[model samples]
Target: MKQARLHFYAELKDFIAPNGQNKTIVHNFKHRTSIKDVIESYNVPHPEIDLIIVNNVSVDFNYIVQNSDDIHVHPANASIKQINIAPLRHLSPQVSGEPRFVVDVNLGRLARYLRLLGFDSLYCNNFDDKTIAEISSITQRIVLTRDRKLLHRKIINHGYFVRVETPKIQVREVLARFNMYSFFKPLTRCTFCNGKLKQTEKQNIAQRLKPLTKKHYEKFLVCSDCNHIYWQGSHSIRVARLIREFSKTDSPLS
Candidate 1:
């Protein structure tokens, strides 16, 4: 077996085994092994890697490991000057128009929060890993999951391994990672069904509203798919506050 040394930089270190953290790792491998497989062997998902340098030269994922070669892996959002390096291959897809997502089964709350901000977040609690991967591949939707293994699928071109566990913090993490603060359009989507919301006249839906709702609110928004009515009731304050919080604390991309 041949041996090479790899150093994972920045947040990429978090994915590696504890003994290898913040240091160079001596990896023993076969002669023709690709760098992509080597990196994933350490639990660093390819989607999270932005650049790889082999012996001071930037290399792509398919670069074969050479015995005694030195490799450096950098995460997405890492600050690196690109003057002399090979063109960095950003693993994340070039998303045009509004960004869309297919959330994993366990990230239902994250999906709802994303939808609340008017982003197209498709989610179902019963979505198996294969189903989510298929949807992401077909729709070009970014996959959001806490499961690192799901991002390893070859068909998933755009995906993220969500590190934060709390839904509120997880949404902020995603916004920061994707630079999506400018895309916020609160209340323009149905949090329940990921449907677009359309303004509906109060008189048209008067029969559905409670007496107090009819008396107090003049404007309403209805989900195009689910037909769920929304008005600026007591919940609006909490929604507004949450929006403000998300806008302010996007945090830096890790």
Candidate 2:
């Protein structure tokens, strides 16, 4: 067996086993093993990895592990200096501009929360893994999910595993990871159907509003797809608080 030293940086350490955090791990391997396999074998999933440096040079996941190789791993979203290493496949064709996301079956609430914050989030609880992968590849949407297996798929190039359970925390996590504060446009989309919202005259949606809603509100936004109506009412303050909290917190990328 051949042996090499592995070092994980930033949030990637969270996936490191209890006794192994922050230390160079000497791993024994046989045959020709890809760095992707080696990393995942040590519990860091490929999707969470952005850049890998073998020796002093940067390399992608497919670089084969060699005896005595010193591997330095960086998180996909870590705030670090630009390096010459080729990013893992999932990091491209470059994460600039406003990024769209595809939420998996378990993240319907997260998908809604993301939409509430103006990110273009697509979601369907019925979307199987294959469908989600296809959509992400075709539309170049980043796949967001709580499932590590989904992120492991070869078809998925851009993806993230949401670490937290609460929807608000997850929102902060995503915002921080993607550096999406500039794109945040609260209440721009229908939280229920992932549809764009248009300002509709009160009278146009008058029949749809409840007596209290019609009595109190002068204007509304209607969903383009389902015509769901929105008004600033009881939940407005909560939404405002969420925006404030996310604006201030530099949530961890894990």
Candidate 3:
């Protein structure tokens, strides 16, 4: 039987069985198998994989594993540096354009912070894993979750496992992860409905707001969908300061 040896690097190692790191596993095969199928067979999603080197040569997902091949897999989230003469060193494109996100139920606070940054972040506690996965694929939005398993799911092509535990930390973590700090557009989107905010005359919404709110806050933005009201209140100031502070730090994703 034809056979090949496999090695996983960095975070890819975390998915391996006990004592799997740096340990070679000999896989015997009858016919050619795609590198993707071989890796996913071991539970690694193809999108999360950044590079694969086989027998000292780089290859993409379509590369067929041959007899006696030595394969090394690297995760997209890893920060490793390697010199390579292999052809498979291509990286997935860096995330560009306006940042958008969809958060799992566990990340409601992070959702709010992303909204505060004026990003279009969708969040609903009612969405099941299947719904979240579907929304992510259809919208091409990045999935934010604390559930590592969700990120590991085969159908989820764009997802990130937020490592931070606290809401504030998670906010910073996401900003750093996406390099979105410099792109922050404060109070640009409706926090309640993920709609773009539009400036409205204070008199137009006078009856909708509390008397005190109408009296003190003359500037207003209203959601086109839910008609929710927003102002640059004290909370907005605090959020802005926090985002500014995070922007100053060296991003972890960099």
Candidate 4:
């Protein structure tokens, strides 16, 4: 049997088995295969990987594995000092405008949280993988998904496999990853449909508001797409607190 030793570094280890973490993984195979296939077999999606070194030589995903090969895989956030490394496959796309995203169906809460912070996040509970991939490919929208396999599609150039499960922490994770602290525009978007919120005259929506809401709140914002109204009610306190919590610096990746 042909054998290769592989080591996954940093956050890339999250996809591998617990027993194989922080150490060498011995992969046994009878025939040669591309490095991409071998790594995906361990469940680490290609989008999460930035660098691969084979037997001390930099190589791309298409590099075919050889018998007795030694492979080292690094995540996108790895701090490698080598300038001569092979060009990475997952280069951050040069987005021309504000970063938009098409989230997976399983990450609906995360999508809502992102929209709450005014990011253009497209999410539908019924959206399938093909639909998400197509949107991402055509619009250059980044894909946020928990399913690693969803990112393996060849059409997906910009995507991230959300590591954390909690919606709040996942928001912080995404902001930290993308350096999006400056992009925070809380309460400027409709959390329900990911539409921009526009300031509307109180009398324009007076009939839609309840008696207490009409009397108590004079200023309001309405969704341009859905016409849903938003106001600074008591719930705003909790939202502010959550925003403050998300604004703090999260711990570094392993």
Descending-TM-score candidate ranking: 1, 4, 2, 3
Q: How do the candidates rank by lDDT, highest first? A: 1, 4, 2, 3
Question: Which tens-of-lDDT digit does each residue in 18-62 have in candidate 2?
Answer: 799968899898889898888888767677777778887778777
Error of 4 at 16 (Å): 1.0
Local distance difference test values of all predictions, in order: 0.86, 0.83, 0.77, 0.86
Model 3 weakest 10-residue run by lDDT: 245-254
When summed lDDT is taken over every stretch of 10 residues in candidate 1, the lowest stretch is 245-254
The residue-by-residue lDDT of candidate 4 on 96-202, one tens digit each, is 55778999999898999888888999999999999999999998899999998899887888889888977777888898877787888888989999989999999
Candidate that would win on TM-score:
1
Residue 218, model 4, lDDT: 86
| Residue 68 accuracy (lDDT) in model 4 | 90
| Per-residue error (Å), model 1, residue 110 | 1.3
Candidate 2: segments with Cα more than 4 A from true spot: 79-93, 250-254
Candidate number that wins on TM-score, 2 or 3: 2
Q: Write the per-residue lDDT of candidate 3 for residues 1-254, one digit (tens) a residue.
A: 99889988876765677766668888888987988788877766665678788877778878888889999888775655563464457644356787778899999978987887788899988988888988988888888987766765656777877766888778887777677766888777777778888999988988888878877888998888788988878787776667676566754312
Q: After superposition, how far is residue 48 of candidate 4 from its true place, in Å?
A: 0.1
Where does model 1 exceed 4 Å of error? 87-90, 250-254
RMSD of 3: 3.7
Clashing pairs in 4: none
RMSD of candidates 1 onward, in order: 2.6, 3.3, 3.7, 2.8
- Residue 154 lDDT, candidate 1, scale 0-100: 79
lDDT at position 37, candidate 2 = 85
